[model samples]
Target: MKIILPVAGKGTRLRPHTHTRAKSLVQVAGKTVLEHIIERLKVLAADELIFITDENGQQIEAFMKRVFPDLNCSYIVQKDRLGPAHAVALADPRIAEGDDVLVVFNDTIFVTDLTRIPELCAEADGLIYSKEVEDYQRFGVNVIRNGIIVDMVEKPDTPVSRLAQVGLYYLKDANRFMQYLDQAIQAGDTVKGEFYLPAVFMRMVNDGLRFRAPEIDAWLDCGKPETLLETNRYLLEERHSCQGDLIDTVVIPPVFIADGVTVRGSIIGPYVSLATGTTVEASIVRDSIVNADCQVKDANLRFSILGNGVRLAGSPRRMNIGDDSLIEMDS
Candidate 1:
């Protein structure tokens, strides 16, 4: 089976962080978001993998080469931010003939092994991972009838179902998917003039193509600032021990502290991750995630996240700061 990972999005929602770094390269729990996706693919024994990226493609390729040396790797540059369907269309030449293809969004991280997808594809045209969410209006909602996807409403006012597509898809016939994509583009079936992959799926459904829906275990979205922090906390909490150092602080459970870190007169988390070369002084950090080479001093931080090389001083009531920032509280 071949895996096509569309990582071409600029991740505008992430703002300054994605401005300086690739969204897929963002680290959480001592691993990049892309790494977690790749690790899950390894369990599925996915033989070939294709990544669609833009300017950051070179760096991602280099990293993949170092980590997945034995896997068949290829890259397709999405020069235009057209849409998801356009992005998947770029994989046409990279995928082999008569091969099952799985197109997974880079921002969606699945905690369970999707190895059964290959077998599932053998019995279905395509399989989409679906999960229940409280707010269906924020995502593409699906309306199914007797195991068939009858309709799709993107951020609808009133959702018919709580199931939302988690961005994991398997297509047994690449040619069929490409044909629908072309038809949708020609017909101007797009969202804000940008062709969406879901449009193609709907087209397929209209043509009597059967697409299955699979319920996933854990589907995480690390595309936003708050979601990134929450995902980091969840990943850290699952681990046994995190790597970090201490100076003179009371460390608590579910915290990850990297090497060369010094904490003094502070109580660190029930769920916190401190990166290397970070220093915390005379403060209490709880339910927060601090990236590499950061410093926190004389502040009470709770349910917050700090990016790399951040320095905090003074005594703020609460904080939610980004990377490479110097915040001095009102002393």
Candidate 2:
């Protein structure tokens, strides 16, 4: 199977953090968000991993080379700022007609048994992974009928279906999907000056192409700040361990304290993540994410996000400080 990841979008929702770095490269639970996504797909043993990046995608290449040197990956830069279909279309030269392409978006971190995908999609034309969400209006809902997906609605006004289309899809015929995508582009099938994947997929659905909408276990979105923290909490619940055995610090379960993280006389977590080179002294931190090279002292930080190289002092009960920012609160 060939894997495709369209990661060229500018994360406007995750500003301040995304202002300095790519959204996917942002640290969560002591590791990058991209790392978390890639770790889940390592068991699939795909043929080649392709990343559709942008011009300033040097950081992505460097990180991937350093972390996954032997993964057999390739990178292609998408110059234009088009939609997801445009980004995926840029990789057309690399994929063949019979190749099975698995397209996964970078904004989401999914938790499901990806090892069983090959066996599950053996007889199907394609697979569209979704999650059953209550707030169906916030996401694109899939209309399934007779055990197959017949239609896809984008953020419907009414509750047509509860199956939210989680940005994960498996295309059995790469060539056919590309052909349809091209047709949509040629036909000016766009929504507000941008081409959408749902339009192309709906076209295919009309042509009698069967797509099985498989419900995924978890769909953790990292698009915004609140959601990003929520995703971090979910990840910590599944996989988290302290590399450093703290003595004076009040360590809590389900928290990730990376190596070189100094925690002195502080009450941390039930849900907290601290990266390396960070020092927390005489503080009580919980439900927060502190990046690397930060210093927090005499603080009561909760529901806070201190970016890289940030310094927090005094008694900031709650915060949303950015990178390299020095925040002094009222004691």
Candidate 3:
């Protein structure tokens, strides 16, 4: 099956990091978010992979070429930042009539078996992955009836279900789905003049397109700053086992320390992730995330997220530090 990944959305929420790198390339637990998606798709034996990107297309294209050199990958630039539905429409040229296309959002990281999707597609015309999240109103919520999608409400004030779309979708009939995309865009019934994919899915429900829901094990949206840190912590504790390079430091298990980091005289983690070029000196950090080129000295921190180039010093007890910030702790 062919796969379409829409990575074009400029990550406005995830600034600084997204400013320098593609949102999909944001690293968590020492692996880029896109890397995790590509790995999972590869396991499913995805035949052709196409990326729809915006301004950061060149960077993503270069990165994908180097990483997945053997895969049949192609790139399409979306000139206008329309919306999700329009982004999928950009891939219409490459999609064939009978091809089954899995449209996955680039920002979502799924650490589960996507291989089961083919089987799910065999039974359903379209399949969407949803998870019971605390904030359902922030996501597109689907109302399913007898394994068929009956209605899709996008960020309704009162959500009917806690099941939120996890940004991964499977379409059995590529051409027909693309036609719905066309209808949604041409109708101009869009949110903020940007055509949304869920609207078409709702139209599909009325047209008997049959959408099924599959509950995924885990899904992380790395778009928000706080969620990025949370995802880092979760991914570190779940996937990464070892922290590279250490000296005179007591590290509890389930910590991720990136390369080129120098730690001396520190007690790190029940859950901690230190990015590259970070230095921790004579301090104790637990359940904290420190980004690259940051310096932590003589501090006791817990449950904090520190961004890149943060200078933390003195006897500071607890705080959340932003990037390129200097926090003079209480000595």
Q: Highest lDDT: which candidate?
A: 2
Tens digit of lDDT per residue, candidate 3, span 1-331? 7899999876878775666668887666666789878888887677789899877888888888899888998899999878888988999899876788899897778766777776776767889888878888788888877776788888878858778898898988889998889988888868987888788888888877788888898887787767876787777767655555778999886788877888898898877878889999999988777778999999888867676788989876556555688888577
- lDDT of model 2 at position 185: 87
Taking all chains together, each candidate's TM-score versus the true structure is 0.91, 0.96, 0.88
Runs of candidate 3 with Cα error greater than 4 angstroms are 157-159, 292-331
Give the true-structure RMSD of model 2.
Answer: 1.4
Sorted by lDDT, highest first, which candidate order results?
A: 2, 3, 1
Off by over 4 Å in 2: 245-247
Candidate 1 TM-score over all chains jointly:
0.91
Candidate 1 lDDT over residue span 1-331, tens digit each: 7788988878888776676677898767666789988888887677678898999998789889998788888999999888888888888776666777788898878865576766665656888778888998888977888776788888878868888989888888876677777888789887776888888998898888887777788888888867877887778767736555566778788777777778888888877777778889999988777777888888888877677888998876556566799998787
Least well predicted 10-residue stretch by lDDT in candidate 1: 239-248
Candidate 2 structure quality by residue, lDDT tens digits, 280-324: 999999989999999999999888888899988899778877789
What TM-score should be assigned to candidate 2?
A: 0.96
How many backbone collisions does model 3 have?
0
lDDT of 3: 0.81
